[model samples]
Target: MSAANSPDFPMFVSVAEARQMLAALLPALETEWVGVGQGYGRTLAQPLAALVSHPSATESALDGIACRAADTLGASASAPAHLQLTGESRAGVPFAGEVGPGQCIRIYTGAPMPAGADAIAPVEQLIDDGPDAVLVQRPASPADVRPEGGDFRAGEEVMPAGLRLTAPRLALAAALGHARLPVRRRLRVALLSTGDEVIEPGQPLLPGQVYDSNRIGLSAMLEECGCEVLPLGHAADSPGALQAAIDSIGGADLLLTSGGVSMGKYDFMRDLLIVQGRVSFWKVRMRPGGPALLGGWNGLPVFGLPGNPVSSLVVFHVIVRPALTGQPVQTLRLRAGTAFRGLPDKVAFWRANIVGGEVHDYGKQGSGVLRSLSEAGALVVVPEGGSVAAGDEVDVVLL
Candidate 1:
């Protein structure tokens, strides 16, 4: 008999236990090289090192004049030092001549420092007495100029492998002269929904029928995690139908099926997994989507999510999404906008939004209500048997 169907295994495991069990089984996706411009949201597979030193030469940081620090010494607002303006240095246009004693070079932002100049004085700090000469009232510090390799040196490791490329990170790669970056290939996840009552959207609805909302919702969630979704559509709640649906997804790295995992008479996923595959865990002791199943089928990892739209998304954010992105979801603590009371046995994920740093839950916390997930920007996690009174601190997971 399979472990899921055996009497020894718990019918429901804690969320932590379920995640820990699956983490050991899920394999890492392969890597590929992609254009750096298109790498946002993708995880890097190789460490990126600097190709050339930034600010290859010492340059000016201000749009003013470059001169010897000694030239401006001992000058004050009342007694100013005057220096002859020899030449000017515009950005990308270097002055061919060097500065000599009692001379300064007019320079703009990012302009290379002249051969003899070691400091820059801002235009506001000096009086421009025509183009021939300038007056500086105070001494310029050597720190006024950016030194060579001020940002990074050649061959220095700037970005490490496994980092999810964000806008700023991509810019860093571009600045390092990498036209392409090595990134992990997107995970392929198959999506399927089970239940006779579930009908396709735009189809005529019968008395007991509802649109297949999970397919679209789950697809979006999987896509957001950079997974290539192989949507297998819907299947009836039956042994044969479930098997056929599973067979349709040929090469998915992960299979995600919504509904049919609970103990209802029509819920066939839990029982079928026990008979045809190896179920890592049958249920998770969490609210809004507690009837979750994780398993392996024909060597492919499978996630059986609850049928309710909101529940599926919550569980995805807490579990599946993190596994795909290879990053832990972000969480914060904020003041509760209202009191929350729940059962002592199950942890609750309350749909919520942060307004002025306060956590406010949605009007309806039901699993089937997609509106709750739509209007919420975060999930307020209420620990088992925990009560959060108004104005109390509660932990939140950002969506």
Candidate 2:
């Protein structure tokens, strides 16, 4: 169906409409119990709370002497305060006796502050006098010490559901005494690239044939989004071959294919799905990826991206990826380094490198120029009928 004629056939849709269709079609996956060690990059299935209070007991935050705050109230360089050293307290070893009015304990970082002591005078502010005495030239207050549960309290929520865990997040979970975490089950994606002229990489290419890169590129992007990819390899342009490939996607959560979605005699993907009236949208009203396709197959969601390398990647970034991650597209307004003329009929996304708030476009904007996309860090978005001049603020989508 042509975009101009398919009014009731659901031909071309705006970017926002495409996203809304994906949101309505896909939902969050099920949950699973995974060890914290294996939780990195996985989304949280449930809210994660602290299992126990961090630093459950009062502990010294630095290498210091633990003493009563009152004893150092008037301490100064000229009128230094002197206290008797009753004992020493190192991490994992507590002092045997309580600190009296004139007594202090030699303590190291992470050591428990002795009983009756309310301050930690760092060693930098103390002068050790023999084995039993120390002189303090400055006062240390309770502010210098870490109290019980200073980091996190038991049962306090530290991570909310749907959050992708990173290294820092995993560290936080570990500090909260978590051995395992509740995270979403890994998403399985069936990947395929269809074209009779497409050959596998590393194989000698014949005339009129190019190597298949969409499968590898899309699979890498999917893995980065925490998906387990089931590579269905390449499919020929014939209907029998495509049907075999489709049937091979046995248990995957979603089907993602590139090529053969446009309006051409050999564009079998669109025609096959259009016959069943399963295709929701056959085109996107966006540059570089106008031929993108979204549809359903045997109750599974399918995303058919354009054949061009850059178009496939861009459509994935703007459509399939966000749906898989359950994350909204984040747009930033940045200063443009050059003028950008918008397309009168479609939304345009130009490959550009953004550095320190300045957006510089890559020289070429061709959907076939994959090298241009490789050099870009973001996509400078130009709305239909909108133009942006140099130094003007424009919307940017980070790649």
Candidate 3:
């Protein structure tokens, strides 16, 4: 369907359609080698394989005496085994002598097993008689040993590409001897806030002037998605100012603007985008953010959100962020008691707080109130023309 006449135009692109558009428009960028410690939260650009064999050689897994399993099998708890302690082996140190029958070596955790050693009797299971000798209280078996390459063999694939490098994953890479990893380069995004009434925060409020919360909020959200946020500041309601702001942000991977995309007389963002870019869609069938714009400006994805505070955030989380991250969009069904009566035909996203397993709608559902959104844990999505009763389930998009 065409962008203008399509049933689900601009705002409410179907989940599949949105994902396909994102994939067709954006391609994975170049990769860079970063240290494993700095890889957390970044997606891997290439598969991370072991640089060398983990452990590099056979090693001990515990502090105890290392000996051949056959040497200790005959002895039992009733009649303890006796073996001469040849030498001590510590972590990162290798035993110099081979362990033969009736011979054992005192080994600590992580120490490499000596040649001919097949099992380890934990220190707790043995009694120390003197510095050179230790007595085993019970017979050890082959199961008591950690053989070579038991954890990981050489040239084994550890972590594959496209994986988000979390803390535990980074640690595993480090343990696998990966000092550096390949990660995707960060996407650069340009942000613009539109409207004559909006003023920068901390500035004295003149008549008809409101603080420019959208710019600040949208910038933080872009950065949270791992983008390099370039704040282009506020654009006046005039088309000249909007066009100037659009031209100034050159070579950005994505352009995000708030306000002036709706059907209002002062709305100029859609016109500006049509002139400089392709306007894919102008409006969506959704509440709180129905007047949204999606297009490509100068070969960069551009998203135009509503001027209201809550509406801007809702669209940002629902559409913009997921498009940038290439993450699949998921619709969650709200727990019982989240439905509202008299919901309209358009999909409505309202701020709600989850307490005691129930979602209570926050007061002041107006898009202008940022405080309501700040206190909300989720966005309760009411489908078109659907009315919900107490304890009825509804779809929710978690913020």
Candidate lDDT values, in order: 0.85, 0.87, 0.77
TM-score of each: 0.88, 0.91, 0.77
Lowest summed lDDT across 10 adjacent residues in model 3 is found at 1-10
lDDT of 1 by residue, 310-372 (tens): 888888889777777778768898999987766688888888878988988676888878887
Question: Could you tell me the C-alpha RMSD of candidate 1 in Å?
Answer: 3.0
Highest lDDT against the true fold, candidate:
2
State the weakest 10-residue window (summed lDDT) of model 2.
1-10
Candidate 3 has a TM-score of 0.77
Error of 2 at 286 (Å): 1.5
Q: Residue pairs in steric clash, candidate 2?
A: none
Lowest-sum lDDT 10-residue window in model 1: 1-10
- Ranking of predictions according to lDDT: 2, 1, 3
TM-score of candidate 2 relative to the true fold: 0.91
**Residue-by-residue lDDT tens digits, candidate 3, 158-184:** 888877777898888898788888889
Regions of model 3 farther than 4 Å from truth = 1-12, 32-41, 63-84, 100-104, 116-127, 135-151, 174-180, 206-209, 274-277, 330-366, 369-399
Better of 1 and 2 by lDDT: 2
TM-score for candidate 1, please give it: 0.88
